[model samples]
Target: MSGSRGIVGEKWSQKILWICAIGSAISLYLVGVERQTQNRFQKMADDLDDIDYSEKSGGDGT
Candidate 1:
């Protein structure tokens, strides 16, 4: 476009673009991996509020 103009340096522009592309790809991969952890937590449902203190060390101070 005539309105958008930049003095392109082969070294800086190419390196920056490559880094941005890799960062976006890694972020997407991490998001996909995190979905499994979210599912595991969701399976707990209402039991999340039930803390089992009786199993603690010294059996909850007897």
Candidate 2:
């Protein structure tokens, strides 16, 4: 009985470890994707800032 219990515990621990490893991988992937999105958006915002909106709109700062 004791031997069976030990085997069960080992199996559970392995399962938990696998779950944690998969979760960590998914979390890292998401973080990387989020960072890439943020950087892309930041670049777009910077480009917009550099654009001369008044010239395009033909407005004299009014």
Candidate 3:
């Protein structure tokens, strides 16, 4: 009986470890995608800032 319980406990612990590993992998993937999206947006904003908006239209509020 004790040996059976030890085996069961070991199986459950292995399952738990696998679950944690998969969760960590998914979290890391999401973080990587988020960082890539953020960098893309930041580059777009920088490009917009580089444009001379003042030259496109009259300087006056007209």
Candidate 4:
């Protein structure tokens, strides 16, 4: 009886550990995706800042 209970407990613990590991992996993946998106937006904003909009407007409408 005691041996059976120990085996059951171990199985439950292993299942819980697997669940936690999967959750952690998913969380990491989401964080990486968010970071990449933020970096892309930051780069786009920087490129826009580098543009000479004033020159393109023909020197303040002549």
lDDT of 1 at 51: 36
Error of 4 at 36 (Å): 0.2
Model 3 stretches astray by more than 4 angstroms: 53-62
Superposed Cα deviation of residue 18, candidate 3 (Å) = 0.3
| Candidate 3 C-alpha lDDT tens digits along 13-54 | 999999999999999999999999999999998766556454
Model 2, span 1-62: residue lDDT tens: 99999999999999999999999999999999999999999999876765668668876644
TM-score winner between candidates 1 and 2: 2
Q: What tens digits encode model 1's per-residue C-alpha lDDT throughout 1-62?
A: 54344444656698999999999999999998899788878777534434344454335433
Distance from true position, residue 49, model 1, in Å?
11
Tens digit of lDDT per residue, candidate 4, span 19-59?
99999999999999999999999999876655656568665
Ranking by TM-score: 3, 2, 4, 1
> lDDT of all predictions, in order shown?
0.70, 0.90, 0.86, 0.88
The number of the candidate with the highest lDDT is 2
- What is the lDDT for 59 in model 1? 52
lDDT of 3: 0.86
Per-residue lDDT, model 4, residue 43, is 94
Query: 2 or 3, which is superior by TM-score?
Result: 3
Question: Candidate 1 at residue 19, lDDT?
Answer: 100
